[model samples]
Target: MATTLKNRSWRLSAAALLLSFSAQAQAPEAAATPAGMSGQEMLFWVLVSLLGVLVLALVLTGILIVVQLRPQLRKVYEMPTVRPSWSGKVLGLFVGDPVLLQGRVRDEIMSGHDYDGIHEFDNDLPPWWKMGFYGTIAFAAVYLFYFHVADAGQLSQAEYETEMKQAALLVSVGSDDPNKLTDFQPLTAAADIGAGKSLFATNCAPCHGAAAEGKVGPNLTDEYWLHGGEVNHVYKTVKFGVQGKGMVAWKGKLSSKQILQVSSYILTLQGSKPANAKEPQGEKDPTATKIAMR
Candidate 1:
């Protein structure tokens, strides 16, 4: 009886230690992020710790199995007729009392009048099932305390807001209002023009031909102002397109710097005069000619 108690105590201790390690692994620590560890590094460390814990649990389980089976094997060696049942002596440790392990023993049947020729047995529920039920209750209480009572974890809405704030930090939001125009000059850098050429090919080249020769749109090469040909004027025109004209507004679609880039790029095509160019639609801008001469 003392040996049985000692073995059971050892099993309980191992379980407690396993639970402690699992709880430590699951609990969130706020200090790691400020310490400059990247998310991937933290996850890698967490996975390594979990793997170590798993290996330790397996070792503890093997130790417990050996401890429980040793005495039973010794008893079998001592007497052949009094040999211990493998199911009762070995597997019974996990399922509870030896008699209860393989369901109702004959002695457990209630000594009462049978109903419909069938006798009922008064048997306790399996220990493993009861333990699992109790575990679920304990887990529910802890989860409720951690998330609601103690407020240790963020709720769904709080997590979403945190993610949005983090995303905002990574992006730069320019306060330049599209309605409020700027007197910005067209970019003259070769790199800026090169980027503008790529952007134009991808976005603007479909409507305004590959060479800005105007397929469905007005010719961009001529000294005519469909919207205004000066850099700032062209910037405004691109930023906010003409209403009732097939020109689509690019305010939200393109960034302010990108609009300026494409506008400056368009201005560079003023004198190319490519073939199959559409007729000039708007009046000539003398201001644009004056700016161009300078």
Candidate 2:
């Protein structure tokens, strides 16, 4: 191949010399033709010359690479070949080699158990997984300390109670609770009586008559009562109505303040005469008399 290349070089040099001589000989003729030829014809010849020069350069480049660079490529295949393990073949792209990718490794971390004569190594957990596990433990500790020990946040039960109290507060806006059965008091303002009158007209006027005059129920005036006529007693009676006496319970239907207002309005009717008042039915009370006088 070397002898052939030497001969080819000589032949190519001779051909180039011949081609240059022919070009010199034709130059005068081509120049005279261009004077007669059109502009497109001249341009076509110029482009053909450029393409021929480019093809020659490419051929020379390929021959130089084959002669010089191919020997270095031959040395690569001659170097010592390492028959890397399967894992090394893949992992060596990024890392050099895995620790126990093949036969038993014998440095330090070998364990006792051998599966069919294969040894095991005690490698620690991956750093990232270990860190995540430890982080979870730390988070749990902080949560426990803050909520239960330090009291920085409410626990489930405490949070529930707080929410319930807030709900009760919202439900009780603009009114007092009527659920406490025995914590009764009297309210005597005109606003209280007027509100009570409105409630009574809706609730009790059918049975007791408008203006507390007698009807199906006894009159509410003239200081007489079934149960009792004291303000607190009246409040209780209205809250927990006479069950068998045809009056339904109002505690379930009214607020504590509403019951107070109704009782107050009834007390104001003590001596006001109404037509066809029902005869008084319950015992007279010393407490009632004292309160009425006051």
Candidate 3:
């Protein structure tokens, strides 16, 4: 009987070890996989890893219970009258739920502890709830190790800093907030103005005509202002755009330097009235006259 019990315990231990090894083997594969996995591929691997962890945890838990209760299990097996049913045997191997076996609950119920003819049975926690709680703990440990200890993943703050650095590369030096208007002098550099003209032809021409004359949107060459005519004001308008005014925000599409270039190019067009110019719509800005002089 002792030999039989040892054999059973050894088998259970070996099975648990095998499962542990299987779960560990997946770590190398995950590490070896390319980081540029598609969304669906990443999700599939994540689910598979979680499933393997859950199965390994359950197997370990069952093996622990079996090893701890080896003597009791042997005695139950030797006693024909108290032998567990087929379902009970399966449950004992995996869940170890005493309620599934006949006479198993006798030791579980509180003796003479009845209130109003109600008796309480001390049962183990539900497997799902216990496993879920344990899984969260495991996840937290892995997250801490991955982000803080091993430095394998970026923390939120680190990621934010990295993104800010990347964005800084796209913007020119002395860039100001697009939301706040600043007295930005128009860029007179030939290269900036040329780039601005090219961009305006591509993006703005469909709304504001090719020569800054009015099309679906207002004429950009006129001194009359719908929003404002100052170079700074034009910069703001181009960056944020006017709501319900057909102008789409270009902050994300154009860098700050590019927007400045476009605004400067528009300023250079003052007084050069294009053919078929739209009728001036807004109050004229005296500032436009001063900017045009620059």
Better of 1 and 3 by TM-score: 3
- The sequence of per-residue lDDT tens digits that candidate 2 reaches over residues 65-162 is 45554555444433445223444334332333333333333345466667887767665555456668899999999999998799899888988999
lDDT of each: 0.73, 0.68, 0.76
Ranking by lDDT: 3, 1, 2
Candidate 1 runs further than 4 Å off? 1-180, 289-294
Pick the lDDT winner. Answer: 3
Candidate 3, 269: how far from true, in Å?
Answer: 0.9
Clashing pairs in 2: none
Sort by TM-score, top down from the best: 3, 1, 2
Q: Write the per-residue lDDT of candidate 3 for residues 143-206, one digit (tens) a residue.
A: 9999989999998999999998898777655445554467778888888888888989999999
Between candidates 1 and 2, the one scoring higher on lDDT is: 1
Residue lDDT tens for model 1, 1-294: 657856675776677567867787687765456477888998798678777766776667666766766677555544644334554445444433354344434446687857998878777676557768999999999999999999999999999999988877765454344444568887878777777788889988898899988887777888998777888888877777878888877888999899888888888887788998888879988757322311
lDDT of 2: 0.68
Model 3, runs deviating above 4 Å: 1-179, 290-294
Error of 2 at 192 (Å): 0.9
Pairs in steric clash, model 3: none
